[model samples]
Target: MTQAIPTPQAAINAVAEATQQTPRKITIAMAQYSQLPIGRPFGCFANSVRHIAHETGAEGRTPQLIAFPEMHLFGTPGMTDDERHTMERSAATDLHDELSDNFAALAKELGVWLIPGTVCEKNPGGYVFNTMPVYAPDGTLAAAYRKICPWRPYEQYTPGTSLTTVDLPGFGRLGLTICYDAWFPEISRNLAWMGADLIINLVRTTTPDRAQELVLARANAIANQTFVLSLNAPEPEGYGSSLLVSPEGDVIAAMEGATPGLLIRTIDLGATRRTQEHGTLGLNRIWHQFHPEDLPVPLPLYGGRIDPQSWHPRHTAITAT
Candidate 1:
């Protein structure tokens, strides 16, 4: 059964209690990787992760979580979107079990949370969706977020419905988004409203539109007051510019060109809450800006209304996308 979160105070308490044991801080590895050839062994990925782990240990810190680019699980660099879709459709059934299991086992063996990028998942109804899965250190599947906004016309895949978030126990709630989904502000806003402190966007772009995506990263972070991290594939297949933005819209880290490199940073959890409590640079508290007793404001475009009452942070705990 889906668990509806409790009251506003109770929700905050739940998050606090879960994060009380350790400092709400963690090191994240944003791997800007290009795809290996179609027949490459999974050990290539394992070795890549191990290399990052070794470097992280050299810095006197272990990797707690690591995220790769959007198409990390399939296709070689330089493939067209049509080619990727073909590969995805062909391999959806054959590769799903093996790839997902490998990622889970990798997470368990490394004792790190892993987002190994989107898999081509076929639902029972025979529709395929671009799905990203999250794995806990214990090899359990923590969450799976489908790409609600698949790049359209040229690239076709069935879209997903639900917004997904995962609690990190000692850290904060992390929300998931895929490549083209960055264009939609509602997706990020809903995640922030659902109590997500950080948004992980997995991207793969080879076009000029990537410049606009960089702008959206900062815009979403500042507008929603949450930390935003985006990782993209490199060179031939992608524009390769990954970004990390702070709650105050500061560019904490970024990659400018099409190069296969990694971005590593230790992010502070609950920075969004702190920003909300103290205001952004002591200037704006967007989440608290609304009147508690205000009536719902209808929007004809969305076919819905905004309710002040539903603005509370008590988010549902269901994990699937």
Candidate 2:
């Protein structure tokens, strides 16, 4: 039940009014960066971001939107014990003022919408949440989405309580979900149902199941009939096949290696409308036929009257007086 922020709509209207004629095509860039040290996450990340802007800006082709990978402020997945200790303290201390303002300034300076992926957002009580904040070209805070599914024992960050979407000028509505959130199909479907034209997966994958995740990405695009952008970190632990899948489940562009590089592509926004009108396997039609009120949620039907104590016999025995 994440509430829609008023800023996105206001920004969308402002852009639309300013640009007059709606843009049919948009350029998007994904920066697949080598992981930086935890001690200097902000400075290192800013440099990598500038690399993308420089490469594209020099070509006289500044992207409308730029995407970065998840949990950037905390470094990558495999950090040393000292690194982790340093990251934890830094996150709890300067996350709000320093890290946030730096990214905002970057977007404003470059004049491009930037998704500087997940920040280790710290709360007043010393608790942290994995959050992604979207900055508009004018350095305005457009929208932010917290990671709904934090990778369990490996990442003990707080789970998000809601789903949120942001509206771009002519890009239609944009949805944000971080790494582990890609594994849950329901969340993507929900975003699509809510009218998200592009669903961006800001990921930090470090597992051997990269192939499986690739399939899942295509499946998500096909099912939702929306463009899917899977941006991954280029860490040694990261599987750097960052991809952009179209509504028809086509891989538009994919990074070749775990090297520092940029995946730049111009996509026809009009294609999203055309492809979704007649979805693959008629999914769009099928989606409209179901009503939430009609669905039934029944209790566990297996006549389960067993005592709670019977479930964990070994644990009970171990703790017995």
Candidate 3:
């Protein structure tokens, strides 16, 4: 069960108040890249990295971290349902480690953190899981997040048991969430409470509803007072609208409907701290004002009892950093 977050930004606000480190800023690349032909994964990903790196370098800014859409390692869509099915099943259910190893090596060679996207891995027990792999610049597998909330009645994969986050040495901590998982407020709240300064949401929406997701991206950012980068699959495969949302709930960069584009932005971690220590527009102080007297509050959703010890906000109200 998740700890009580009286409001969305409460946990992050609590975390923001306790920290005193100098603010961190890192440039991140969101590649709303469409799937390629059903073949090897290295070429497409590597080429995209090289091209993007070179392009950004021309602008005198190199992306430190790069992310693609959900299931990006999987190939492009097929014409018929059967063709697409064969393409996906054959690629995802393979018993090889090439995709993982090759990408790991690529990240090391490129010297950039990479979130290539999720895959249906047939791990040791022969059970398939929809998992997202995070590769560090050193090529080590930093973190792999399995999809906890699969699109119900449609996606029948094993659910991930634990939430995952990655702490960069220089940059701030990052929480990972996939597609449908973004729909649940509890997921981001738990991540924010767990000390994530940024949340990366990988999306793969083949149908419509990306508009709603756009709203969720902003809402989650505002609620947690944390940076959120939502990368969606490109064009036809997905209704593209990838965005980089700031802690202030502002859309720093947004792509138009069902179109492919790239976004690179250096985010300020100090903003989250500022917002948390202060408030959204200096008005919403839901995180800083926790009251023990409210323990009797009943939550019918989860047996209607808010634990004071567990629900207590972790930080005291402070005027300044």
Best by lDDT: 1
The per-residue C-alpha lDDT of model 3 at residue 275 equals 71
Ranking by TM-score: 1, 3, 2
What would the per-residue lDDT of candidate 3 be over residues 1-321, giving only the tens digit for each residue?
975544656655554654454656677888888866667547867888877764562235788888888887676554575565556666674324787788788889889998877876666665667788888999998988888898876666778878988877766678899999999998997787776778999988977788898899999999888888888988777888889898779888888777788887777555665676666765565455556555565779877565554652233222221
Candidate 3 — which residues are off by over 4 angstroms? Answer: 1-21, 57-59, 79-89, 93-96, 291-298, 303-305, 308-321
Report clash pairs, candidate 3. Answer: 299-304
* Model 2: residue 267 alpha-carbon error in angstroms: 1.2
The C-alpha stretches of model 2 lying farther than 4 A from their native spots are: 1-23, 41-43, 57-60, 76-86, 93-95, 281-284, 290-321
The sequence of per-residue lDDT tens digits that candidate 2 reaches over residues 56-146 is: 5323566878887886556635666566755665654333586678888999988888997777777776667788899998888898788
**Per-model C-alpha lDDT, please?**
0.80, 0.72, 0.76
Q: For residues 167-286, write the lDDT of model 1, one tens digit per residue.
A: 887778998999888899999999998888899999988798899999999999998888999888898778998999988789988888989988778877666776655556655668
Lowest-sum lDDT 10-residue window in model 1: 312-321
lDDT of 2: 0.72
TM-score of each: 0.87, 0.77, 0.83
